[model samples]
Target: MNNRLRTTLALLSLAALAGCRGDREDAPPREFFPDLDTQLKWTPQGRSEMFEDGRTMRQPPAGAVPFGRRAGVSDAAWASPWASERDRFLRDDPAYFDGTSGRDAAGNPVFIEKLPASVSVDKALLLRGQERFNIYCSVCHGYLGDGKGTVGVQYSPVAADLNSPAFLVADAPQTKDGYIFNIIRHGKPKPDGSGGFTMPPYGHAMSEADSWAIVAYVRALQAARSAATPTTGGSR
Candidate 1:
């Protein structure tokens, strides 16, 4: 209670306060952080965080997602915070395939896209189709639509016999055109009798016009195969 005692106590209190402040300076205070008004400003870890019940703060599990959300897949939730990473390695990115506008930069299905309607039996287009098929499709469907390609048998589910009437060389070329387009555009979701999945949709690699070109060529090839059935196969 005397002057010296009082002075000593005040100095000790000040020293303790300074020590606490120094410790705080080294590491920002975390104990009191939760009580702050998080609604006003969010720190780096708070931007995409969600509050389960307005109190329980939750973050998407690392490599996890919410309901109706694709965590880290090609077809995952695009608007999620971590989408770019998902697409980097997908065998087929849906964004790259779907939501396209055959004309516009982004596919929106806005205008009457004419790619399917525009294709014809142009020799050049048909030739292009032939070359492309030889490279992409022939490995499985065989050069003559027979399910005899080496790759076809390698698959767990063998490829379909394209020469079959249900699929190939239909009596009417026009009817076959649309069917062929569907096969190329969406691919056979289920391979016929065979188990191997059909080729993924080529609607990404080639334009719709090119798809029809390929169809036309296949139809022509089918006709040729039928006409030249000498019990001999030399490839049309």
Candidate 2:
């Protein structure tokens, strides 16, 4: 071919390549496979003609029960030998339900001063409590129950020291098991009701039995810490 014609052809080929390339900086690329986008489907509150009700959604089957819930179980079936008599005293005993002990001279409801009758301190119970405490409470309370946990250290307000005398009321009076159970079930709120950094309640996540177990574990930790500390006169 002639030189002029070859040069013209090269110029046209370059222009075509430039057009195909387009601009590097632009909007996001279009979908390569748009089949999913175009597929027919019914979204929430959408209508459909397949059902007699002419609605896309249908009600759940009658008597349906959610996970971890009992529907038709009887009280007799749930009762255990380990359950405290106070729990069985009335239909719902205050000790098991509200964590109350006995009323003082005042009309106020006095909280129980000890562990639930159902819970007995044993090796197995302590082990279970230890496992649960490490999983949930240890994040803020520390593995040693010293309130120096990783998250607690960085927290704005320091976490409570489970081993501290104030925690178990060691000097004035011993701490009550029911009180601890209540705290675990209903989380501790901040001094002010502002509600940002307070401990979250574990009632929903952990069962009542498990909550008791955690309380047991905390008591064990306190006992151990007390024994380890040296008295003024001699070592523990």
Writing each residue's lDDT as its tens digit, candidate 2 over 108-146 gives: 657677777866778898899899999988888899889
Report the alpha-carbon TM-score of model 2 versus the true structure: 0.55
lDDT of 2 at 199: 70
By summed lDDT, the worst window of 10 consecutive residues in model 2 runs over 65-74
- The pairs that clash in candidate 2 are 101-112
Residue 192, model 1: Cα distance from true site in angstroms: 13
- Model 1, residue 154: distance off in Å is 1.9
Q: Could you tell me which residue pairs clash in candidate 1?
A: 99-107, 100-107, 101-107, 157-195, 157-196
All candidates' lDDT scores?
0.59, 0.74
User: What does candidate 1's lDDT look like per residue over 47-157, in tens digits?
Assistant: 433654443446568755333434534444554444533333342332233322243456333322123332455789889889877877787878886767789867656
What value does the lDDT take at residue 30 in candidate 1?
45
